[model samples]
Target: MLSSYNNNKVIYSGTGRRKTSIARVKLIPGSGKLIINGLPGESYLQFSPNYLRISCAPLNILGLHKEYDIYVKTQGGGLTGQADAIRLGLAKALCSVNPENRITLKSEGLLRRDARIKERKKYGLRKARKAPQYSKR
Candidate 1:
């Protein structure tokens, strides 16, 4: 996820995944601002305060919400998935900036990957676990 940064500036980065969504996130020293998928984070999320909060949970939890700018490129899944992915990626970037953040992030459960995804349907079932019907004649 972390590509590179020039020596003239400092940037931290990481990758985050949720469901089928993936986000590449970068953090830079600047006033709080967010750019995601070529759109401002707020605008991209349709100005939904809830999703904005979810995407910045890790920063808010660590009191760094106003200290850095966030950049995210995300695809796949829906808005919620992308937001959670950003949160996880931001947590990882924070850890890279300060190792001490590792414990905090871990304690906040931000460093854990969400592995749950859609289950495949079984060969003889209509769904992952549901059967077509029961005949008792």
Candidate 2:
């Protein structure tokens, strides 16, 4: 038997992928604060103001002005990769909160996963595509 209290507080989980990185997010309705793992808010290695700004954009668009703290655990990504992953996670979380907002968020393309990665360097090349000095003598 399920209790009524559990109904109001929904636990929504979502995953975001970018390049080789992956981010997993669990959203619960509460005060505004970002948590990664069991550590405090300041413990996450990829904390960035810009990331938070971009990730939280969906909340604002959905008219959820008040703070809704999020608990996220992300791995296999760099700082920028993690940020974009978080953004996707946040967007999915917003959708879970209310399905009606899907059209709005979808139109903005916030749900899309970025698939750009570093190009591997080719043999005999200085870089991914740059070639060594050519001699025609």
The candidate scoring highest on TM-score is: 1
TM-score of each: 0.93, 0.80
Predicted candidate 1 versus true structure: per-residue lDDT over 14-67, tens digit per residue = 999999999999999889999999899999999999999999999898999999
Model 2 is weakest, by summed lDDT over 10 consecutive residues, at 1-10
Please identify model 2 stretches exceeding 4 Å from their true place. 1-8, 39-47, 65-67
Q: How well is each residue in 81-104 modelled by candidate 2, as lDDT tens digits?
A: 776787788788778767887889
Query: Each model's C-alpha lDDT?
Result: 0.92, 0.73
Global CA lDDT of candidate 1, please?
0.92
Q: Model 1: how far is 115 from its true place, Å? A: 0.7
State model 2's lDDT. 0.73
Q: Report clash pairs, candidate 1.
A: none
Name the TM-score of candidate 2: 0.80
